[model samples]
Target chain A: MANTFLDRTALNDLLNGACFLGGGGGGPMSGARPLIDLIVKEYDGVTLVPYDSLDPELPCAVVAGIGAPDAATHGPSFSSAPKDAFLKLQAVSGTTLGAVLPGETGAMNSIIAALVAAQLGLPLVDVDSSGRALPTLSLAAYNLATEPTVLTLANQPVTDEQQATAVIETRTAPQADSVVRALLTTQAFEQEGAFSTWLMTAGQLPGASVDGTVTRAIAVGAALREARAAGDDPVEAVNAVLDGQLVRLSCGTLTAFSSHEGGGFDGYTIVLTDDDGHVVTVSAVNENLLAWRSDSDAPLAAAPDTLAWLAEDGTPLSNTDLRGLTAGTRLHLLGIPAAPILRTPLLAARFAKELAGIGFFGQAPRLD
Target chain B: MANTFLDRTALNDLLNGACFLGGGGGGPMSGARPLIDLIVKEYDGVTLVPYDSLDPELPCAVVAGIGAPDAATHGPSFSSAPKDAFLKLQAVSGTTLGAVLPGETGAMNSIIAALVAAQLGLPLVDVDSSGRALPTLSLAAYNLATEPTVLTLANQPVTDEQQATAVIETRTAPQADSVVRALLTTQAFEQEGAFSTWLMTAGQLPGASVDGTVTRAIAVGAALREARAAGDDPVEAVNAVLDGQLVRLSCGTLTAFSSHEGGGFDGYTIVLTDDDGHVVTVSAVNENLLAWRSDSDAPLAAAPDTLAWLAEDGTPLSNTDLRGLTAGTRLHLLGIPAAPILRTPLLAARFAKELAGIGFFGQAPRLD
Candidate 1:
C-alpha cells in the first residue's frame, strides 16, 4: 500500500467524508474543521502511512477528544492539545515519539491524528484503537487486555488561561473509564475535556489497534462523495467501501429526541416512527449504544456494533449535530457490524454491565 | 536543631496533638491514627529531622490527604496510597527520595508524612508546605513560584478494591489546584481523595516551605496536653508555644453551623452568639478563611492566618468534628497569625480569589 500525502485538498475530502464514518459519535465536524483547515493549509501535507509500513517498535500516541461533542464548539478546537499530550508523555517517559494514531475512528478524531502527524512531522498510522466512535474508554481494543492505558486530559479553562493536564494510569479499561469520567464531572474541567490515550509502539499496533482504519475511512468518504455526485445513495456507496456490512436498519421521521449531560457524557433517548407506524427507541450514552422496537425484548443492534444516522441527502449526523434536529425531522438509521477484535467474549463481558446500566437491557449483538 | 527519632510515644503525641493543629482541615484523626500507629510500631521509629539539621539538596516529597477529611471514614483507610505516591515519583523521576514533608499542617495530613517516611525508611522533614491547613492548593508557600508541582492521587475504590492513581504535573500552583480539583470531581476518585504533592529537595525547603511547622505542631500539642494536666488554660499554653501572637477572638455558644460539599471541598458558614449578644460569623471552604463580628467592617481574622476552634475543654475541632455538634454548644475561638512565609504578598495574593469565592470577605491576614 502506498502512503498518501493529505494536503489541503485531501484534508477537505477526509474532513467532509469522515463525519459519516464517525458512526454518530466522534463529535461534530464544525468544532474541529476550521482548525484542521488552518493546520493543513499551513503545512505542506500530512503523511498517512499504511499499517504494514510501520516499524513495530516505533512509539505512537493515540489522540482524541473525550467530552460532549458540542463542548468542542467553544474553544481549544483542534489546537495543540493532542500534540502537547504526545510531547508530555515523551517528556515524562524520556522517549521520542515516532507516529500518531487516532484513539477512535470518527470524522473528527480520525483526522485530528492526521493533523498531529503533520504538526510533529511524524507518520499518521493507518490504524486506530477503535474502528468506530465509542463512548467509554473501556470499550476500545487496546485496553481489552491487562495493559495499563495511560490517559491525559488537556483542559484549558476559558476563564483561566492556564491549561491543566491530568494523567490517569490505571490497570484496567474500566478503571481508566471511571477516572476519565470523574475528570469530566469535576468543577475544574468546565464540564468537558480532550484526551490522548494508548501510547504504544508500531510493533504493538497490530495487536493493539483496528488495522487500516484510516484508509477505509478515507475510501468510504471518497466513495460517498462520488456516489452522491452520480445521484446514487451514499449508504450503498459506503457499504461498497467498508469491509463490514452496513445495514440500513430503518427510515423514519423522528417523533421525539431528548438528552441530558451527566457523568461526563450526554445520555440521549430518541424515538423514531417508521412509515409502517412502528416506533424504534434508541438509547445512547455519548454514542448510540442500543436500538430496539418500542415493544421488544431483543435489541435491533447493541454495542460494540456501530450504529449511525444520516439525513435525507445521506449526510452523516453526529449526536451533537442531532441536537439541532427536531421531532419531525426525517432520518435514516444504519447499523454496521463491529470489527472482529471488538467481538471477543472478554471485551463483551466487560461492556455488558455499562451498556445495561445506561438502559441497554439486551445481550451484545455478535456477528461471529 | 538535631533530628529527633519519633518513637512510639512521640508518634502518639504527634498524632493526637496534630489534630488540633489541623485548623479544622487536614481530614479527621480517626482515618489516620491507626495507620500512624501501625507504621511507627513496625518500623525502628520514624526519624523527624529539623530543617536546620538536614542537607538542603536531599529530595523530599510533601505528602497529605487531598479530599474531604470526613470522607476518609470509609474504606481505603490509610492503605499503601501514600507510599505508592512516593514510589511513583521515584520511578518517574529516577531520583531517590531522602525526606518527606507534610503538604499541610492538620490532624491527618500532618501525620501522614511521618507514616510515609516510616514506610519508606526516610527522614521526616520538620517543615510543611503550609504552616497550617488551607483549603485550596494555591494557598501554599511552596506553590507561590512557577516551579512544577507533581501531584498524585491514589484512590482505592470501595467497590473494585483496585487502586486508581492520577498524576498531574503543572507549571504553577493554580494549575495544580485546578487539576487536583478536577480529579476530586471525577467519578474515579471517591467523594474525597488523599494525595502526595510538591516533590522537591531538602535544599529547596528553606525557600519553598513554611519552616519548622512539624516541630511547632508538636510543641503546641505538647503544651496543650501539659496545660490540661496542670489545670492551666490549654489555649494560653498553645499561644505561648507559637511564635506569633494568639488572640482570643470570642467565647460563645454556637448558634448555627451549616456546610455543603462543593468543588471537592466543604463550604461552610457558622454563626456564634456571645453571652453579650455579639454575633460572629465564620466562612470556610474546607479551612476557615474569614471571621467577622456583626456590625464590624473589619474581619477578626482572615485566610493565611490560623483561625481555629476548640471545645471548652480544649479539644481541637475539625470541621467534620464540628458537624456533629449541636446548636448552642459552647466553644472557644482563637486566631493565630499565619507563618511569616504564607503572609508574604506573593502567596497571599494567589489565595485571595479562592477564599473570596467561598464567601470569605476579607483580606489575607498578615503578620509583619
Candidate 2:
C-alpha cells in the first residue's frame, strides 16, 4: 500500500474514528483539534505508511500522552512534550527511531504520534501498540515483551523556565506504567506528561502490534462523514466500517455523573436513564472499563470491548467530552467489539485486571 | 589534610557522629549498622580522603538514600541500591566517578556513600552536600548549583525478582527532589529508594559543599565514646568536640508523639515535658526541622541547625530510633550549630521552606 498523506479533512476523520475507538478515554478531541491543526499548518501534513513497507529491521518508537485526560486540558499545553520525549529518547538511548507508532488509538495520543512523526520527518506507522485506548500502558500488546524497555517521559515546562524529564528502563510493562503514573504526581508534571516507549524494530511488530489500525480508524471516520452527508445513520455507517461490531446499548438522558481524580487517572461513573425508566451505568478509570444495566448483576460490556458515547449529531464523545455534559443531556451509548488480537487470552487477562480495578470481576462479555 | 582509613572502630565512630548530625531524620542506626558491617567485611575498610587531596578535575557522585527512613528498615534491605545508583549514573553519563561524596551527614546516608566508594574502589570525599540531614535535597548547599544536575534512583527489588531504576536530569535541585519523591510512590520503589546525584568535578566542591564533615563526624563520635568510657557525660563530650556549638535544649520525659506519612516523607511532632513541668515540642518531616518551648513564641532551634535526641545510655537517637521509645522514656535533646557553610543566605531560605512545611513560618532561629 502507498503512504497516505493526511490533509485537514483526513486528519479530522482520523481523529473522529480514533476518538470512537478510544472507548471513552483517549483524551478530549477539543485538545486534539488545535494540536492537529497546528501540526497541519507547521508541517504541512503527516505521512502514514503501511507498517509492512518499512524495513523489517528499522527501529520505531511508540509515542503517547500519559495521565488524566481532563487534567491535561488545563495544564500548560504539553504541545511540545511528545517531540521532546521523542528526541530525548533517541539521544539517551542512541537509537535512531525511523518511524513513530501510536501507543494506542485515541484522538490525542494518535495525533501526538502523528505530530512527532511530522516534526521528525519520519513516517507514522500504520500499526498501533493497542488497537484501542487503554487506561494503562501495561495493557498494550506490544508492551508485553519480556525484553527490557527503555521509556522517556517529558513534561511541559513547569514554569516559563524549567522542564522535567526522566528515562526509565524497566523489565516489565507494569513497572513502567507504575513509575510513569507516580511521576505524573510530581510538581514538574502535575498529573500529565508525554512519553516515548517500546522501541522496536519492524521485524518485532507482526505478533506484538495491531496492524492497519490507522487505516481502519481513517476508514471508520470517513464513513461517518460520508453517511452524514448522504443523510443515512452515521452510527450505522461506522458500524458497517467496523464489520458490524458496534452495538447501541441505550438512548437516554444522562441523569448523573460523578468523578474523582487520583493516581494520575480520572475515575468516573455515569448514570443514564431512558424515558422508559431503564437505567445504565458506565464506569471508567480513564477509559470506559465496564458498563451494565442498573438491574443486571453481570456487566453488559467490559473491556477490552469498547464503550463510547455519541452526541445527537453523531460526533464521538471522549471521556473528557462526556465530563462536560450536564445532567439531562441526551446521548447514545455504543459498544464496539475489540480487535480480535485484543481478545486473545493473554490480552484478555490484562483487560480483566483493569476491569477488576473498577469493581468488575466477571469475564469481558462479547459486544459483537 | 591526609587521607583517613576507616577501620571498624573508625567506621563506628563516623556513624555515631553522623547520626547525631542527622538531627532526628537520618535513617535508623539499626539499618546502617549492618550495612556498615557488610562494607567493612567485604572491602576491609573504606578510604576517606580529604577533598583537597583529589585531582581538581576528578569527577564524583553524591550518594544517598531517598524516601521514608523508617520504611527502609522493613523492606528488602537496599544493601546494594546506593552502589547500583552510583554505577548506573556513571554508566549513563559516561563519567567515571573517582570519589563518592556523601549527600548528607547522616548515619545511613554517609555509610551508603562509604559503601559505594568501597564497592567501586574509589575514595569517599571528606566533604558532604549538607552538613546536617535535611528533609529535602533542595536544602543541600551543593545542590544549589545552577547547572543541570543528573540523578539516578534505583530501588531494591519490588519483589524477589524485579528492580526499578530511573535517571532524571533537571536544571534545579528542587525539580530533581520532586521527581525522585514522586518516583518513590511507584510499585518499583514503594516509598523507599537510593539515589546518586550532583555529579561534579573536584573543582566544584570547595564553595558548593561542607568541607571536613567526615572528620568532624569522626571527632564527635570519638568524643562520645571516650566520654562514655571515662564515666563523663557523653553529651558534654560531643558538645566539647563541636567547640561549644552544641547546647542543652531539654532533659525530659517523652510525652506524646504523632506522625503521618505522605509524599514519601514521615512527618511527626514530638512533645516532651521536663521535671519542673517545662514542655517543648519538636517537629520534623523525615528529619527534626524545628524545636520550641511551649511557653515561648520563639523557636529554640530550626533546621540548618540540628535537633538531636540521645538516650539515657548516650546513644544518638535517629527519628527511626526515637519512634520505638514509649512515652515517659527519659531523653536528652541537644542543639548543634549548623556548619558555617549551611548558614548562608540561600540555604537559609531553603530551610525556611522546610520549616514552613511543619507550620513553623518564622526564620530558622540561630542555635548558637
TM-score, cand. 1: 0.50
Could you report the Cα RMSD, in angstroms, for every candidate shown? 23.4, 22.0
Q: Highest lDDT: give the candidate number.
A: 2
A1-368 per-residue lDDT for model 1 (tens digits): 98888776666667655676666788777876765776667787789898678777777777777877656656556566667677776776677888887888776787777877888888888887667888877777876433445667777455456677888888777888788878878866655666776767777766667887877777776776787789898778887776548887778998877777777888777778987877777777778877766333345676788788877676778877877876577888888888878767666766675564552322455533
Q: List where candidate 2 sits over 4 angstroms from the true fold.
A: A1-368, B146-148, B158-160
State each candidate's chain A TM-score: 0.93, 0.96
Residue-wise lDDT of candidate 2 within B245-319, one digit each (tens)?
Answer: 788888899887877776888877787887668777777888887676744435667778888888766778788
DockQ of each: 0.01, 0.01
Per residue, candidate 2 scores C-alpha lDDT tens digits across A1-368 of 99999878878988998998888888888878878888889988899999899999998888899998888778765578999999988998898999998988888887889889888999999998777899988788785443327899999885667788999988888788899999998888888899988888888888888999888888888987888788888788887898877898878998877777778999887778865677777888889887767444346777888888876667788877886776667888898887777866777777866754543333456776
Q: DockQ score for model 1, please?
A: 0.01
Interface RMSD of each: 27.2, 25.7
Estimated TM-score per prediction?
0.50, 0.51
